[model samples]
Structures are given as C-alpha cells and as structure tokens.
Target: MSERTGWDRRLRVRADGKGLVGHAGVVLLRRCADQVGLTGALAAVLPVGVGHGWRERAAVVVQLAVAIALGAVNLSEAEQLALHHRNLFGPAASDSTTRRTLAALDESALTRMAKARRTVRRHVWSLLHLRPGGFPWLSVAGRRLKGWIVVDMDATVITAASKKERAAATF
Candidate 1:
C-alpha cells in the first residue's frame, strides 16, 4: 500500500468576495424567527437598558436561544457564531455580556419572558401545523398505563489510572 496521508484539493479555487462561509443553518433559524415573531415577542417582553439599541434586546435573547439550541454549553460558544456567521446573526455578545444580561433578569422580567415564550411557541406550533398531544400511554402485559414516561440517566464510569482528588479505583 502506498503511504499518502494528506488532503488533496479536488475543486479549483474561485475568487469569491466573501471569505467566510459556515453556519448556513442559521438562515433557517432567522426565517423561522421572522415567521414566528420570536424577536418581536421577545422585544415586547424583555427589558431594555439605557444603552440598548432598537433591536439589541431581542437580538441578544434570540442569539442566546439559538446558541443553546445549537449545543453551546457556555456563552463563549457564541464566539463561534461571531467568527463564522457574524453577518447573519449580527454582532455576537461576549461571554461576559451574555452572562450579565441573563443575570440581570428579575422576577417580573422572568414572568414576562415566560409569557412571551409561550405565545411564540403557540404561534410557531400553529404555523408548523403541530398538534399538541396528550401524554403517551402504554399497553403491556395485558395492562394499560396512562400518563407514563420514562427517563434513563446513565452515569459515566471513570477508572483511576493515577491518584488525584476524589479519585477512586472505579466510579
């Protein structure tokens, strides 16, 4: 067998005006936001600070939600969007900015946000033709069970190859 382990270009390069191209999926999210009035609803419910721009509050909240949906465990992941799709998502908030924004939420703001989210959810469900169904039931062993749900949270097993804090042989 020949030993060749490097990537080879298959397509000719064409000079494009833009250098960045990724996270095109965010376009779908933007369209969905427009269709469901997500940003508008959020703007109506969220509090705007003195420095807030016309759409800053909605933009930040929507970006955070999108980041979470895209599997961001922390606010720093917002930087990925900033790097790749800044034009699509607008200016991405820094990790500290995101943390401070969320931390500033008060009880009344939380309640309003909840209401807005519910409203937006209903609108989107209707637009998507989603039917809210009751809890799934199960029939097993000649018995019928209603309102049954199951969750399995399997734990990870770690083996101690070296000694450290709280390190055990097996956990």
Candidate 2:
C-alpha cells in the first residue's frame, strides 16, 4: 500500500498470459495523479468534512474523475470503482457522499479548485521545459510555433452504416 494514500500498489503486470485484471489502466491513472501532486493539492484546497468516517474530499473528486475517464456517466455509476477493484482503489466514496461534496462546492471553492488545477498545470509545464528538448513545438501549415501549447477542440463526425432510433446518421 502507498504510504501517502493508503491505496494498494501490489499489482503486477506480466505477459505470461495468466491472471489478467481488467481496467488495470485505472491504476496508472491514479498513480499519475498522486505523483503529480494533484491529489495533495486538491486536498489542501478543498474543505475536509468534520467528523470520523469521512473520506478525503479530494480523493473522492479524483476517484470520480477516474470513473468518468472509465466511462461512468453518473455518480451512481462511479460506485463501480469499488465494486471489483476494492483492493486496488481502497475505499471509494459513496454516491450520496459524492453528491454532497459537489453540492457543497460554492463559487469560492470552485475558484480555489481552478487555481489548484492551474498551479499543477504550471508545475507540469515547468518540468516539461526542463527536459532535454525543452517544451515541444507545434507545426501547422508550414508554420512552426514554439513555446506555445495549442489545444484543438475540434468535433469529429462518424457515419454509421445503419441508422437507429434517436441515433444520428453522422456525429
């Protein structure tokens, strides 16, 4: 188990073609969050509930984010994280707890969360800048842009062979 988060870290990966665990990618995602200090940063900014048996708010938020990344559409679905992955995930917050945590976030709290995210982003970029090649450059239309991160949020449309109810032919 990890000393910082108390999550199990005994997972082993092998190509022996035996004892496969599905959705193991979540472990890597969780580790990345921990290594990047995102979990600690969010915990420092968020309010910790007063009383025993209360899980860390930041942990719950991170778990929910991971659940979403794993295709969970709602808080109830987030419970899937604890269903079969208890050993890997430790104790996950209940859906009601998640709802309450989200509901308790006011404007100020949201601002703090945003600031925390920005801080982490800056830290990560600084680390990237220290790499051998420095920050990566982007080339578009024969124009090379350095020291700038370009995010493309273009929407993609996929055509379906057969149309179904409430399903668009192309999306």
| TM-score, one value per model | 0.58, 0.70
Instruction: Pick out the ten consecutive residues of candidate 2 with the lowest summed lDDT.
Output: 1-10
Measured by TM-score, how close is model 1 to the native structure? 0.58
On TM-score, the candidate that comes out on top is 2
| Per-residue lDDT of model 2, residues 70-95, tens digit only | 99999888986645566666777889
Which regions of candidate 1 deviate over 4 angstroms? Answer: 1-20, 52-55, 128-171
* Clashes (candidate 2): 1
Q: Which regions in candidate 2 have their CA more than 4 angstroms from the true location?
A: 1-9, 14-20, 135-171
On residues 36-99, what C-alpha lDDT tens digit does candidate 1 reach at each position?
Answer: 7878887887766675543366677778777777777778886576545565544677777777
